[model samples]
Structures are given as C-alpha cells and as structure tokens.
Target: MKRINTWLISTWAAIIGYFQFFPQDLNNLWQAMPDDIKASLPPYVAKGVAFALFCAMLIGRSVNTHKEKKVLEQKVEDTKDDAAA
Candidate 1:
C-alpha cells in the first residue's frame, strides 16, 4: 500500500509540475475538454477540489514516512541490543 501510494503521489506531482512549467500546453488541453464537462465545474470549484486532493495526498505521504521512520528506528535499536548481548 505504501509503495502504491508513493507511486501515485510521484505521478501526480510530476503531472502538476508539467502543467506548471507548460501553461500553454495545459491551456490547449483544457480547451480540448468537452464543453459539458467544463461547464459542469466552475473554475474556482475545480481548483478547490484539486487543492483538497493534493493536500490529502501530502498528508498521507507524511503519515507513511513517519510510520516507516519509527519502524526503522525500532529495528536499529533491536539490532544494537542483540549485538550488546
């Protein structure tokens, strides 16, 4: 699950970076979207939704990193104890 989450976060970050660096390309893509789909979402609302999703992904990644760090620390401590004994 962590691997999958990391992959998804990396993919999303890359996509966002591409759009940021290539606004003209993004604009062209947006123009190509179906009118009904575009009309269904007010621009601000769409931005807000995207922002919320990005925040959620960031938080999930942070939590996973924290958990992995704790597990690694514990393993290191266990190894030290075994060596000492």
Candidate 2:
C-alpha cells in the first residue's frame, strides 16, 4: 500500500514537472488554429489551464487517499485496543 502511494505521488510529480518545461508540440497544437481564434488568447494560457486541471485531479486524489488511509488506520488501532482490553 505504501509503495503504491509512493509510486502514484512520484508519477504525478514527474508528469507535472515535465509539463513545466515549455514544449514545441503543445505550441504547435495551439498555433495551428485560425487567426481569429488565435487573437482571443495567449498560447501559454491554454497550457496553464491544462496543468491546473491535472494538478487539481492529482491533489484531489492524493488527499482522498490520505484521508482514507488515516481513517482505516484509526479503525485498526481502535479494534486492537478493544481486543486488548
């Protein structure tokens, strides 16, 4: 379980970190649009939005997992205490 969590966190971190480095492919994707469309926004804005969504999901999942693990740990401890008593 711990190993899984470690791996997940590392994976998310790596993905987010990689995106932080500006890439040409994403720029191309953004620039391949028509001029009228391009006039509406900046290039990095779209990338930023994508990164924000990705980070949100990653953080959300991490928090939920941490909460669940804590709850389960507490339940286990309580059960052990009751058994001992």
Candidate 3:
C-alpha cells in the first residue's frame, strides 16, 4: 500500500513538472484571448506563477514528509527502549 501510494504521488508530480517546464505552443489560445487582457498581463507571468506554485507544492510536501519521518523515528526509539526495559 505504501509503495502504491508513493508511486501515484511521484507520477502526479512528474506530470505536473512536465507541463510546468515544457509548455505547449499556445498561439491559438493566445489568439483567442482579448487584446486588452493579454496586454495587461505581464510578460512571462505564467512562467513565474508556475514556478511559484511548484515551489510551494514541493515545500508543503517536504514538510509533511519530514514530520512523518520524525514520528516514525520516535516510534522506533520508543520500541527499542521498551524492549530493553
């Protein structure tokens, strides 16, 4: 179950990473947008936003994993102490 969960999470991260890193040609999409809106948006704003979001997600995931590891380590230590007692 743990392996399956890890695989799924990794798969999702990879998929999102690809989209954020290598965006598809969206000339048609841009063409569809109104000139005023496109003009208002800052150049490279999408790339900046993507990078910010990716960093935020990775940080959150890292924090969660760190907490889980700490808990597991404490549990192992407690078990060893109990065995010695």
- Compare the candidates by lDDT and give the number of the best one: 1
Scanning candidate 1 in windows of ten residues, the lowest lDDT window is: 42-51
Question: Using TM-score as the measure, what is the rank order of every candidate, best first?
Answer: 1, 3, 2
lDDT of 1 by residue, 1-85 (tens): 8789888888877877786688677667778878998899765554456567878999978988999999999999999999999
Question: Candidates' TM-scores?
Answer: 0.59, 0.54, 0.58
Per-residue CA lDDT of model 2 for 1-85, tens digit only, reads 7677667767766765766675765676677988887898887687777777667867877898889999999999999999999
Among these predictions, the greatest TM-score belongs to: 1
Residue pairs clashing in model 1 are none
Over 4 Å off, model 2: 1-22, 33-40
Question: What number of clashing residue pairs does each candidate have, in the order they appear?
Answer: 0, 0, 0
Q: lDDT scores for all predictions? A: 0.80, 0.76, 0.70
TM-score of 1: 0.59
